[model samples]
Target: MVAMTAAVGARPARAAPSAARLRAWGRGAVGAVILVAIILQAGAAPFVRGLAAVSVPSVVAALLLTAAATAAAAWRWRILAGRLGLALTWPQAVSAYYRSQFLNTVLPGGVVGDVHRAVSHGRSVSQVAQASRAVVAERTAGQVVQIGLAVMVLVALGMSAYAPAVGIVLLAVVVACAGVVVAAAVSTRARDVVHRELDAVRTAFGTVGTVAKVVVASLVVVAGHVATFVVACLAVGVDAPPQRLAAVALIAVLAASIPFNIGGWGPREGAAAWAFTSAGLGAATGLAASTAFGVLAMIAVAPGAAVAAASAFHRRRATRAAAVEESS
Candidate 1:
């Protein structure tokens, strides 16, 4: 009876993790399906051509733009961290941000990088919770600003065929959020976390001029990404009007924000293909452009890989030195 009871109690615990694993696999599978569908629809020629089309000038431009964006993003993150009592210097934030970008580019789920950076930073500050919150707040703020800018771009020059659909989706989101707020008010656990997040956002934006500074930083990041995408499109010979191309590029960037992606591949490419097609550009052209953009993105973050290696080396060396000191 004792053994049976123990097994029965352990079943629920095991089931929870099993369910979580199942969901993760499901998400990955969806991402894979997206890529496979794109490949089936567009063929591999565009992708190969895209890789071939990358030139030295384009690579240099991408690197410079990426650096500028990384700096701005790091500044935004530092501002949020400062307000959260998890302050770190701008240089530290930039290195950590680069590390996160590299990891996100190479890893599945697209957010493993951010989580790693947050935990490591948290540990450094001896305030893991605050540091974690700062990261979350920073990411959340970036996404919000990006979406806001997307809406501005799209509305100003939208040839989008599904404007009504997008509006409906936004409306639905607002309603769902309201429902969540109501539900959280009645739920002890949900209320606490929701309130905590709300407080964190308020604190992060509380200071005079902080909001303007953050918005500027976010704009610089957005401009860099959009400009890089444009360069990719140009490299692939997409001859659409400047405004329309910018709109399509912004959409592609927003799609990259989707979490269910394989190293930031699936949604971005898929959306670009569709958006370009809608904009009267060939679907293959969009695929090629997005593919080129992805490659440039990887190249731009290559420094982060070096940073990760050096940081690991120093950490191991420090551990050994400490061991020796203790022994003596």
Candidate 2:
């Protein structure tokens, strides 16, 4: 019986990597499809135009805005981590956040960097699960704030113009989320995990002051992103009113959050094109703005490259030291 159990466990252990590989391949395929669709619909002219429009000043502004956003995000993470007993300092969180942003911008799955940050932090504290939950909470809080702001902008700009389509999309999302909740509630083990995560969330965000601070920080991050998008539009000579740009920009921001993207390329451009066209702006203009935004965003996260390089060098040094100690 002991041998049989051991064999059974070994089968899953061998299969795990294969399963992970399959999932990664699937995500890549989806991203490729989305990118292809965008190219076919929008053509490649806007991308070139966006690149041409980039200037030193615009890039500098993007970098500064990105830094501010990253700082705000790191601050929020620090608070959540502290509540979860993870002991992350502000500087550490900012560095990790920068590295994660760079990884997400360049990696196949836009979330790889975030996953790395969570796992690395968790390992350090030996509270892998809690650490992971902190990331989830931080990200979830940001998304909630973004969505709320988007809704407000949409409503203020008269939702009737975009209501039918946006409402349908939102309805589908709500239904899908409800289904997941029901499924989790029905599964005993899943329910336990959900309860634990919820408890962590409550502990981290339960206090009014903490909740307020998180919301404010998230708002700052969102505002920085929106400002960057506006800058991108201006660089590309969109020449639209701030309100109109803000509305379309918010929509594009929401679309970018969708997971199907080739290094954050596909859905964002498509959504931008759609949003701009719906708002009576040229689709090409939307594409140009989206392209510029993408470039500027990549530039803004350039610091992450330094952080990642330093991290790799440190790890190599540690490994060499460990090898020497082992030999001795």
Q: Where is model 2 more than 4 Å wrong at Cα?
A: 1-25, 164-169
- Whole-model lDDT per candidate: 0.78, 0.79
Q: Candidate 2's residue-wise lDDT over 155-206, tens digit each?
A: 9877456555456457756886696589688998667756765688789998
**Which regions of candidate 1 fall more than 4 Å away from where they truly are?**
1-26, 162-183, 322-328
TM-score of each: 0.87, 0.91
- Looking at model 1, residue 161 earns an lDDT score of 62
- Candidate 2 lDDT (Cα, whole model)? 0.79
Candidate 2 displacement at residue 248 in angstroms = 0.7
Can you give the lDDT of residue 124 in candidate 2?
77
RMSD of each: 6.9, 5.6
lDDT at residue 319 of model 1 (Cα atoms)? 100
Candidate that scores best on lDDT:
2
RMSD of 2: 5.6
